[model samples]
Target: MDDKNSQTQTQINLVVAEPVIDIPTLTHRGPVKQRSPPPILARFHAGYFRISLSLCGQAFLWKTLGKPANDSFVIRRLLRLLPSTAFLLLWSIALFILMTLSLLYLLRCFFHFRMVKGEFLHHVGVNYLFAPWISWLLLLESAPFVSPKSVPYLVLWWAIVIPVVALDVKIYGQWFIKGKRFLSMVANPTSQLSVIGNLVGAKAAAEMGWKESALCMFSIGMAHYLVLFVTLYQRFSGRERIPATLRPVFFLFFATPSMASLAWESISGNFDTPSKMFFFLSLFMFMSLVIFFFF
Candidate 1:
């Protein structure tokens, strides 16, 4: 009886046994499993994307209704409504959340500097440097609407913008000058972040009456933008390789030049010849994008 039971258990084990190796099939059938981004990267993915909100806020603030006003009860009430308040709230929340995430990200990188440097810092992490500063720009711009006389807010903006700008220098220096690895990473739209950050910084600086600093930042941004723009255009035009999910971000091609124009106008005090040229360039890019995307 014992021998019979033992034999039965062995037979059960054989019946349930799994293969130790995957057998190669003659035909491929299933969808391939896509590799996920690393944990450190995936955690701050949302932070990297806060630029979309910043851009939207900038457009609404600078282009559409103009800056928020608290001169009258009616205007203040209007600013408090869903549309205006929504933009302010969205911009504020995005900035704070990203700022916190950025601090955490930096702290983690401190401990795992080797792995981060070898992997993300050279790749995805470099692109993310723009998000925090862009958030800062949005926050700086928001001060007038939130509190017109908040000196502390302005002071904080100055403090934050310096380090953010320095971080950009370090990262871009590594990529463009030291590593010379920019060409290999040109496909992603987020690569435009450095230029966008500078242009936005120019706007912020100009608002603070730092015209010289604004011009310097804007010039550096525009100089690099021209090269990046042409390279990215050449890259994307040759291939329909971008995933459909990522197609919306191509709007950034229009955004960078638009922002450059706005920043130039801010610095020059008028939309003169150069400013108009930048504006027209942006308009053309926008129109081209619309036609291509819709048609």
Candidate 2:
């Protein structure tokens, strides 16, 4: 029995020492390399929400900061030279991109539920979702100029705003009601922008003559902004752990007040005392930001 076992082991060792050649059943081609899908077809992640930066620029330029420049003689003359249809076509392209991204984002969230849920638990990730609603409102603001008296704009506004408001309530409930670490979470500037998104919606609602709804949204947004402001200030004053990559979001401190002023002025139909106060507050915040960063 021992001799038989030794013989079997020696045979196995001989087999192992011999290199077996893998004969190809068919002709071999080069290695299969995976190519990434095009942007349109690619699976979007939560990070795609940063496209809202474009929406912010659009809102700031056409809606608030550069409204005067947009109406200037040079631009007006240039616009006059182009066909009126060009404006609508351009806006249509932008709207299409926004809708496509939003649909893709939803699909990603659906397919990757656990991953997306984890992202939502993070303060920045939850705030990033607000980008879609912000872009929707920004696009809606251009509807009047693109096609005056268009019913589609009103329809789209209701479709997006109602759901966004519902989402805002749900998200804030989770963050404020359920979250025990809400104060520590406020070190992230992106979280405050979620509150600003309500103001964006309020501006659009006011434009559509939904005064009561607009007032409600604006009030809720301001109330939350105040709380978030204090919480973030606390984080800034302490030895909080903030990632260097996200430090630029601190500019949101100024942007929130600036946008609040714009929304207030829009809803009130006048640049009254409160609007002026908000604007000055934004100005002070801007100065503070500059001083903090520069020095």
Candidate 3:
């Protein structure tokens, strides 16, 4: 029995060490000796959630940060002179349309429970499930019509943040309870998204003046992030598991700290010392990545 368990562990290590990902065959199956693209990719999976997520984040930046960033003399003198809620509204409408279409596809049409089950079990794909909710929360935070302390706002926050907290339990619970064939073996940069999603939720909670809730969410995200950060930093597992095309996602390294700074700033009611440290760290990481690409 011990030998059998040892052999199973060895096979998992071999599968993870490979550079190529057989998305179709990521499920548990007997040795099939061949691989092909999963038809499911064309159908729909949580993996594609990242597409609209990227656009939603960009819109969030424009609406939530870019418009108000007129402290610079040039921006204040010229751009601030031109009032254009029109562009922001246009972007918001487009983002809403995209989110509607994407959610309709993911949830309305048959809702592939089997495929979702597979995604939950698959390490890389599972992490992406967080992207959709993260996108929605960012859009909500950026929505001009929503009053942060209003009843509807509170309801929507619960509707979105509850799922994130639930997923944290299921995923992080597994990380805590399972020592074999899990977390340490499969932790990847994508896992960082799960952390980011929680931080995003924390920021939203803080916006609504829910300080206790914000700290609770923030602690969960930062705790797991620290563990995963060290794991990926040391290349403890799943480092080579990513493909070259996905290397750009390493940018998320700095993004995590950037998001942390914003969340902490909101929680503390000031961009205080800890927030400054986080911001500086994010800047340093951004420059490090820039230099990395330069050479």
**lDDT, candidate 1, 1-295, per-residue tens:** 9998887874334466643334344537755444333456434443344554555465346323444443555545555554656665666565566566666667656655665565445444456656666766665665535442367655766776686678667766765665335544434666677788888888877867788888888988888787777767675443324456656767888778877877888788776888888888879988998999899
Q: Which digits, one per residue and each the tens of the lDDT, describe model 3 over residues 1-295?
A: 9998887874334445663345333337654445433455446766666766777776666565444542665634564565568646656775776676566556623445666677788877778778888888887887767889899989999999888888888889888787753567877788899999999999999999999999999998999988888888775633337767678778889989999999999899877998999899999999999999987
| Model with the higher TM-score, candidate 2 or 3 | 3
The 0-to-1 C-alpha lDDT of every candidate, in the order given, reads 0.65, 0.70, 0.78
Give the total clashing residue pairs for model 1. 0
Ten contiguous residues with the weakest lDDT in model 3: 18-27
Sorted on TM-score, highest at the top, how do the candidates line up? 3, 2, 1
C-alpha root-mean-square deviation, each candidate: 11.5, 8.8, 11.3
User: TM-scores for all candidates?
Assistant: 0.65, 0.72, 0.78
Candidate 3, position 96, lDDT? 70
